[model samples]
Target: MSGVDFEQVMQAALAADAGVAGIVSRRIFPLSAPKGAPLPFITYQRVSGAPEAVLDGDAPCERISIQIDAWAKTYGEAKRLAKAVRGVMAGAEFAAELDEDRDLSDEEARVCRVSMDFIVWA
Candidate 1:
């Protein structure tokens, strides 16, 4: 419990979500998606994290700042996928919130991406 697998926990949370799975299927990946894998996929990157301190010791689950990107062939799809991600985070039992969001253009990959920053305790 001390060395929590935040990435695995997050990926499971997203993959098990019906709404998220409908659009991306099982294409959720860590750090980055595979090169030329497919469209309408998801990628996540860890920005930073810190263990919560208590009087006796640190909490098992740490506070993590993560960036999640929804990539698609179209801007609309990316936005929609991003919306689903936001919804899941909002409805989750754990502590999670959207800190920021942005629309990115991947000229090299010819894809539209909706990037989101979230702070989560996991």
Candidate 2:
């Protein structure tokens, strides 16, 4: 955690996976996607995790809470993209683990979205 680049680690893990790379082409956005962008993309945000304390001046254990979203034109595609994301996250060594998964689709926008929450400890 002291010398770790959390975001780079996550991005590298995702890019290294063939399944995820093929689907999204490493189009993982931070915060939001571009206007009039293409479908089948990913967006993620980092939220602050709960504070931690340690006795005897030990390095405190901290966690990074990240929310990942997959957006596509169809439900199946969105789900596939999410599955790829989950796979990458699961196989990574950030001390990251899955927390929750949610579906957030908008029919009017013709966009299918799947949200996944994961925790990485430092």
Residue 69 lDDT (model 1): 96
Cα lDDT tens digits for candidate 2, 1-122: 45765777787788788998898887878889999778888888887765466675644666779998999999999999999899888777765788999888887898999999998885
Alpha-carbon TM-score of each model against the true structure: 0.89, 0.88
Question: What RMSD does each model have against the real structure?
Answer: 1.8, 1.8
The digit string of per-residue lDDT tens for model 1 on 24-111 reads 9999999887787888999999999998999999877689899999999999999999999998877776658999999999898789
Which candidate leads the pack in TM-score?
1
- Candidate 2 local Cα displacement, residue 14, angstroms: 1.1
> Compared to the true structure, candidate 2 yields what TM-score?
0.88
* lDDT score, candidate 1, position 33: 79
Scanning candidate 1 in windows of ten residues, the lowest lDDT window is: 1-10
